[model samples]
Target: MADELLRASGLESGYGGVQVLWGADIAVAAGETVVLLGANGAGKTTLLRVLMGLMPAWRGTITLDGAAVTHETTDQRVRRGVAYMSELGVFPDMTIADNLRIGSRFAPRAARAAAIDALYARFPDLAGKRRSLAGSLSGGQRKMLGIAKALAGRPRLLVMDEPSAGLSPLYVAEVLAVLGRFRAEGLALLIAEQNVAFLDLADRVCTLERGRTVFTGTTAELHANDALERAYFGLT
Candidate 1:
């Protein structure tokens, strides 16, 4: 992929002594949306952590825009246009506006203010509660705020972990619609999600089994493979 935005080859990482990823490889192209699917404990979160520099990779090379970034720090990666939204969502004690400020802190003062205003306009629910603590929001609203904060940074590649987790159907639809708008705007996304509903937003799907990437293909190709379904979803 000539326009590849991020690529990881032979990725291996774990906590303390336990190895979680075993030679996982994945790539994301500019303006593309790649969905990572796996069962619980399949190393999905670990992979995201390694990519974001939150954890060290025991062995592998990570490249962003064709430059090696395996050794970069989390802040370094963020400065290089990579923004991550963890599965846990936002800082509960912080006000909604404060959370957005934290995410957009890398921008200039003028740009940061503009970004916050844009976020408020984009997420009216959060706008109404901009002064409220994040802890006061519902699970779904927190998810929305997390995503909004990530976008406030103006990231080129937004890596999200389970953006739809614990949301009602209505919130799920709203989240999907928001993602669709970003996709249309040519933002690259690498999302780790359990929800199959995200297939509609993905340009490609990568499946992991036991910390290793076992499949990479289009949604149509994934739907046609019963073996992959069984391996990733434990379906018959």
Candidate 2:
């Protein structure tokens, strides 16, 4: 991964009393879409929080753009060009426009309005809902608004958690398509997703179990040995 934009080696984190990630090692190159797949409670969210600097790392290292970010503050990370859009709406009560504007907190005051306007121009649906409260948007729209808020800051890396979770079929497609669009924009992404079908959109897929990585491969390999996925996922 010579072009890798972000990397984590021996990454471990969790509640103060215990550890969840057991020396997990993963990387995502510039503009590449890398997906992390795992069963619920497998430390997926914890790992994301650690990468975003929301949770302190108990041990190990994290690098963004080849520079060590192990000690950077969460806002420092954001200013360094990594945007996180958690599955939970981080801006629930704010209007779509406000949410995007709020994301500009890390940006220079002079550029904030231009940034928001650019994102609004890109996501017309959100632009349409700019005046409406975010709580009033449909589930899918809320999800889109969250992503748009992150993108408004013009981040180099977009880390999304279950962007398609709990969405209707149409919204799911829209969300996944947004990820695809990220690739075209040359924005690297590290996504945590539950739907196996979306694996087709990823450049690489890592499957985790009990906080350990068990599989890292291409979609064709996964599709050919579907049983392996079932076995790894405990579908039986």
Candidate 3:
């Protein structure tokens, strides 16, 4: 495989004294879409926070293309091209245009306009909302804005938390379509969610129980047996 865009080994983290994640290991290579599957309180969100450097790692290591970033701060990681997109719409109070501009702070001023245009062309639904306040957009459109902002930052690894959460079924399809386009363009995604319906769209699926990765492989491996899927997801 190509170089791993993001990798975490023996990663352990949590809040206060209670651990939310323990020795979770996963890797996303260039051009791969990896789905993280778990039920509520499964530590999927906590793992994403730790890997993004938003939460401190009590143990283990995170490497980006062979460079150790385990000790890097959130800002440092962002500078190194590890931008994360929260499920909550980013920049909901600002115009869609301004929301896009804020994420281009690291790029040369000359490229800002071109980046916006490019993103607009890539996502026309968001293009229509360019002049509107992000808060006024639909849930799907707001999710699009969050993703577009992350793309504006030129990130190598897109760590997303529940990109399809709290959306109408139609909106879910829209958001998943955007993710498909990104996947085709060779972006690495580390998505955490309880939505099993969309997990099959990913290149691989990994399940987390408590804080440990109990399974990691293709979506076929995960869904080949209905009983296994139920058991893996705590349906049993």
Candidate 4:
């Protein structure tokens, strides 16, 4: 538990009186990459939103780095070292450099420029496209920009929603490879994904079904579970 960076228990939420998450529980340890896998419409994104504090949890407790943050605002969470990369992410109309600068806006004014520079160093392509509009980039390039933006804040925990969604296979590998580097750098990651490509990067896997966690274990355990494929696909 001391190694845990983020933990959510008894998570429940819904829209317009229709419940989607039912007492779901999950956690991500420091420097660990935990993959949330499930079929479409399985509440994967909803769960990520709840954990990121973008959406209120109806009944749950969320702790970030040993601090209770169930009620914390999204910005507050970011300030507390939690950064989220949404499915499509933000700042589509801006230039790559501008988007990264905005990510460091909450940091000390004197350090913001340096932070953006660091991100550019890490993502050289972004540096080359600094003046290019984010909307002009390819799908993979956009995903990279979003990730670079998240890292500009130097977060301890990175919550990404389907980073591989709608990406070409080559782009998916590139994106996942970038995430792999983050894990190596001791940044905890909680990624909601339907893509098995994420499996290779995960330290553990949690499969959700109808807002409930049906499986939580190492990659080996997940592979050994015969019911996983069926359960994930809603096959009888």
Candidate 5:
């Protein structure tokens, strides 16, 4: 696990007086993509929230680059090479260019401009409308912009929650292609998604059941397990 970039063990957290995670464990290696798969209410989002520091861990340890970050604030985690993109992470009122600027604010002042420009070049749809408000874009475009913003900071690990959620088939394919490009560029990613199509992009898969990690293995391993796949994916 020397190449491990992010690790969470025995994670336990939830809303006030309500526990949602029970000793869950997950990890993402350097330059790897790990997908989180589970049924609804299985704590995928909760675990992600804890990992991103948006919620306190009732009991557990989160490490980034071999350093313990269990209690670090969200901003601290971001500064330590972690970037999170929630389902609706974009700032609706902000201009596309401004949003990218905010995303790269943590990056070195000298590098921020180039990074933003690079993202604009990569996502020309946004480039053509850089001056427009993010709110004006379609749902798919908003998600794309959110992703570009997250990458602006040059994070070592990018944690995303349902990047393909609420998108049309075409948009979903576009999002997956963008993710594939990033993966090829060696950006580590941990994604929580319900789309089975993600299996094509996953290097590993982790299944959560009732807040606990019931399975973690290669994508092929998950495919080979008939019952487990049926139980979680609702494939009869």
Candidate 6:
């Protein structure tokens, strides 16, 4: 499709010969949110790692904006307008601004300052705490900082693994609201999450079962087909 920003087909990858992904096919369009849902050990994080180029794909092709990126390094993919974020691994000792600075360093020098400034404007609270140690921030603020770091590179496609994995209800709402703005600003997002809190942010939902994509449809369709989801999660 003309709007498609990221496409992965026949993706198969695993750790040390233990095959995890089974010919997974997924796509994300510009300004669209595709929520990936699954139970524990369903290969959600593995799929994100493969998409971000953090892990090698045994077989498959990943295309971004019509260019093949299957063999591209994670840094290469980031420079090519793909950004990734996880629930962990923020630099706790660094200031919020500094963490973002590291993210923007790979971007063009001309755009770095402007990108940081724009992030501050989008996150006013962050603006107030820019110079403070990131470790001192609240759980929600730290997550926001992680998100800000990803945005510092100004990626067209954002691939996130469990953005709200261990947050309180209030924090989850805040994070989801932040993601909603990313969608409104025309950035494509592929999120792997187990929470239905993401339903409001998703344009489509895809469920994975035993490393395979078993359902892909609109949110309404997913809601109408509880039995399908139940079966995939082995609730039967």
lDDT of each: 0.92, 0.83, 0.84, 0.88, 0.92, 0.88
Q: How many clashes in each structure?
A: 0, 0, 0, 0, 0, 0
Those runs of model 1 whose alpha carbons end farther than 4 Å from true positions after fitting are: 231-236
lDDT of 2 at 213: 68
Q: Taking the tens digit of each residue's C-alpha lDDT, what string does model 5 give over 1-236? A: 86988999999999999999999999999999999998788999999999999999999899998999998899999998889999897999999999999999899999999999999999999999999999999999999999999999999889999888899989999999999999999999999988888878999999989999989999889978999878756787
lDDT of 3 by residue, 6-73 (tens): 88999999999998898899999887889898887889889988998889999999998889999998
How would you encode candidate 1's per-residue C-alpha lDDT over 40-124 as one tens digit per residue? Answer: 8899999999999999999999999999999999998898898999987689999999999999987767899998999899899
lDDT, candidate 2, 1-236, per-residue tens: 77888888888777878889887778888888888988788888888899999999888899988899988999889998889999975577877778988877888888989989888887898887788889888898888888888887888889988887889989888888877887797988888887775776788887767777667777667655677656544564
Q: After superposition, how far is residue 221 of candidate 3 from its true place, in Å?
A: 1.3
Better of 4 and 5 by lDDT: 5
Which regions in candidate 3 have their CA more than 4 angstroms from the true location?
225-227, 232-236
Clashes of 5: 0
Model 3, 49: alpha-carbon shift in Å? 0.6
lDDT of 3: 0.84
Name the TM-score of candidate 2: 0.93
TM-score of each predicted structure versus truth: 0.96, 0.93, 0.92, 0.95, 0.98, 0.94
lDDT of 5 at 111: 97
The residue pairs that clash in candidate 4, if any, are: none
lDDT of 3 at 131: 87
